[model samples]
Target: MKTTIAYLATATALVALATAAQAQDKKTLAIVVKGLDNPFFEQINLGCQKWMSENADSEYQCLYTGPASSADEAGEVQIVDDLLTSGVAAIAISPSNAPAMANRVREIAPDVPVMTIDADFLEADRDLRTTYLGTDNYLMGVKMAEEAAKLKPEGGTVCLQLGNVAADNINARAQGFRDTAGGAEGIERLAGEGGWTEIEGCPVFTNDQADLANQQMADTFIANPDLDAFILVGGWAQFAPQAYSQVTDQVMDKLNSKELIIIAGDTLPPQTQAFRDGRSHAQVGQRPFEMGYKAPDVMIQLIEGQTVEDPLYTGLDVCNQDDPGFCKDN
Candidate 1:
């Protein structure tokens, strides 16, 4: 009887080991983000790639693809379709829209689970999504408003440069910032006309010739030098120095007292450098890399028929020059 009991225990241990090994042998996952031109996405991709390589026991792979800019929804769609055809076990995406792509993702990868990161699709069918991993957009907006209010407690004309207003993520943030500061005394929201464009998308040679769109931004600032603050809905402030360099030498004195507090939604390497160099006031940062790192793991768990959470609300923090010593913490 004792020998039988020992034999049963040993068999159970062996089975458990074998199951663990099988779990590690899962196939690769497809992680499609918006664009790599932005360091935020690149950093996230790097984290995902690093985690996959380091965990050699896992047979997972990451299929990374996106356009040079986030505006290329067709390009993103093509990549997702291709990955679906290529037999990836699952896919993670920062989708362009909720209705348009959600249906297509369902049509293409019918059996596979789709996880939305950073940007969630509003019309996405519950069955198509295993989880939504990203920040609570409305809350972040409120946070931005609070920060912006602190800069101009009395409320002045605050201009908002909404980046990709079509994208729900940016829109939510813009609205959040608005709601946060809407009630403040003398606070006025001056909506600016602009969207997300590549930094290199518009480069200046001698800071004299105005790139059309940037010129418009400069004009707005010049017109409203008294504007209490300029809120960049995305990390659009990173492009400001280059834009301002166009007229700084001419109007340094004018800008000295203007006190246009610049606030942004996310932190990229350039934006981080901007804050360090005194170009921006504050940046909301997230552990963007971890999104890439965990994207595949979450997908793998779903593919293996293991239960995964329906949504994972990640966090983002604010960073300024004061916290330069802890850039990593941000």
Candidate 2:
């Protein structure tokens, strides 16, 4: 009877392993971003689909998801938990809050690979992720500063407009701006413009809220007429049709005439259209599609026993009015 029981247990163990292998073959990848309301994340979603179609031999599938905005840190964490429960082979997250997600990433790292794209965790929790696939955020900041300096060589007051000031990537970009164009070369930052709440030079969160972004933008331009330029580190306003109307009516002409310069991040259709129509000046375009495209490739690489030699950072292409090809193609 003991021999019979042992044989039955061994057979059951083999069957369980076979079942787990089958599940892995059918496992889906979750590409989670900060929010879904924006086109950057949509490009990421498209990129994933495109890649999967091209790599049919890999047999990998992906699901793109996000919360309402970049401010929803808890919502983002919950998405990760949900993906974990759903049995994803791997997870690629563009966290709204890196430090906040560190523990969660750490908790699941042993079971499956967890990597970061776009924004990354603080140094202490950096190892929680299997790899980081995005730009050197600080370099992106430096690039923005260089472009701003190039545009307004005469130097004037500039203010920052962005989302989620608490993010590490946001702070890194802000610091990069400080290091690159923190008013050292005669350009003054609009210090506490009109006594609005200031955190890393961004008074209003915008929360990716079009109306609020437009309102804050109009107020900033109207409040400080001589405000010279805007460095939208996380360019949230340009997404909405109604967004920046007042700024366009009142301030965009300055941009068109080269009197006022606006440099934004993330190039989407809205950005392309605005640049074409002279609503905004230039975009320090972060390729969300490319980031999205690489995300699945990276995850599949790990899933299939391939190695990541480097972080696989995306390029920051600056699409001014002169070149909207990238925008149109995207």
Candidate 3:
């Protein structure tokens, strides 16, 4: 009877191990970005999917979903909800609006681990997420300003194109630029026809909007033809050299010269090309692919009883034409 009981116990243990293996094998991870249309996010999603497939023993699935348009927060919320309902074990998101989405996110998937990448849910509850993996927006701003200072050692009026006013991450980057530029002696941030807000710089389908904003930039250039530098909170300002070239002869002339200093955030392929073509001086490389590859690896660690930390900033870089790793080596 003792031998029979021992045999029964061993079978039970084997069954438990099999069950656990099946559970791990069936788990899925969902990634939701701000928008699927953005090529930057596309690269990130691709990296995540690659990691999931390569690490198949983890039994993880990667699902990527986003809004149709960059501004579609409601669509993002719905996607998050759907992912939760689909029984994902983990989720990583680039939040669209932290304040509005926090409560909903917590309510829908209270136990599943959630993370933010590239951007964060700043207004969410302290415990609302398992981790935030991306660049520190404030530091990125300071870097941009430092580059700005290098361009005009004497300092001059700098026009900032702040993008996505609804995004706290972008706003923090903008605020960082504002704070740093103010402290730099001789750097004067213009007002009225001077600095453009995110709402003002937000892109629309209209080419006229681009033309109008370019005219506004030209008008500012007219007032201070000496406007020697520009700091974009993101990639928005990178477009200025082209638009301003068409609108003002002065800007056209300086497009290829050292007269204009352009610095921005997030070095994407197009942005890298833009820099190579002399449209932007430097870019803060957020390293989206690294972030993508790391997120699942961290989640796997969590499943294996390893503790994951909050606010894990994967990697960051400053890139220009000469930097060997500025863009993809390819």
Best by TM-score: 2
Clashes of 3: 0
Model 3 stretches with alpha carbons more than 4 Å out: 1-25, 184-226, 236-250, 303-305, 321-330
User: Ten residues in a row with the worst lDDT in model 2?
Assistant: 192-201
TM-score of each model, in listed order: 0.75, 0.81, 0.75
- Tens digit of lDDT per residue, candidate 3, span 259-328? 8666767776666666666666778767778777787777666556677777787666787645625653
Best by lDDT: 2
Error of 2 at 244 (Å): 2.4
**Predicted candidate 2 versus true structure: per-residue lDDT over 152-237, tens digit per residue:** 76556777766775577776776676566654432234343322112344445666556677777787877777667777787777
Q: lDDT score of model 3?
A: 0.63
Cα-based lDDT for every prediction: 0.61, 0.70, 0.63
Indicate the residue-level lDDT of 109 in model 2. Answer: 58
Q: For residue 276, what is the lDDT in candidate 2?
A: 70
What C-alpha lDDT, on a 0 to 100 scale, does residue 238 get in candidate 3? 36
Residues 1-330, candidate 1: write the lDDT tens digits.
Answer: 543444344335434533554466656576777654455677778878788688766666665555555555555666567557755678788876555667788787557878888777764365678787778786787777776665657666656665443466666676566656664323233232121111211121111112433464566666765655666666543544576455334444543444666666677666666666555567776667778877877887878889877678778787754454334433
Predicted structure 2: lDDT: 0.70
